[model samples]
Target: MIESPDGERTEHCGFIQKRGTNNIAELTAAIESLRRIPEGAEVILCSDSQYTLKGLGEWLPGWIRKGWKTASGSPVLNQEHWKLLHQEYLTRKVRLEWVRGHNGHPENETADQLANRGLTLG
Candidate 1:
């Protein structure tokens, strides 16, 4: 998570489940981070995954109305994480920022390391 002055903080958390890919992992992390934030705080989510950024930022509402199904009528991946994010977003202001992976931004790098370590330990 990235914390700034003025009581602002950015959180990014995820998990690598047995069948989960990196996209799912990143989404999971982002959702986890969102859950820990206090109500009414402004949060900026930085992620390298465009799928995540676009999915949550743009496509989520329609998907939710469709019961988390995709255009092809397939169930959406990572529904639990998506649901959690959706719920938390209802109570806060969240902005998703896309960052290039491995580009050496401090918080992104740190979050990446923590995510990888979480994978190993899990």
Candidate 2:
């Protein structure tokens, strides 16, 4: 879910792939949100998954430095998505925030609802 500074809120969702993990879903959400937000805008991209936030905040740089490989020389799990997200991430001023999931965060609840809706969509 993307919320505007004027209190406007929007939900984004879709079938990412045949199968995916929560981390992938989080990355997808961040990617989609970053794409939708205008360039040079202030962004607070929040997620419940540490894997996604950590990848963006910490692991992404190392992965890039290591040529998209992990510290152990294995390929990063979601390189394609990470690449896109990283591209968008660099174009804006974004504050990555980690929110506790299912703890009554309105945006998180909306995101959950949107995700559930995706399960029923074509």
Which lDDT values do the candidates have, in the order given?
Answer: 0.77, 0.88
Clashing pairs in 2: none
Score every model by TM-score. Answer: 0.81, 0.93
Per-residue accuracy of model 2 over 1-122 as CA lDDT, tens digit each: 78899999877788766588777887888888899999999999888889888988999999999999999999999899899999999999989889999999988888899988876775
Q: Model 1, poorest ten-residue lDDT window?
A: 8-17
Report the C-alpha lDDT of model 1 over 1-122, residue by residue, as the tens digit.
75765757554444464788776777777777777778788888778888888987898988988888988889998788778777887787888899998999777788878877677765
- Per candidate, the number of residue pairs that clash is 2, 0
Instruction: Give candidate 1's error at residue 22 in angstroms.
Output: 1.8
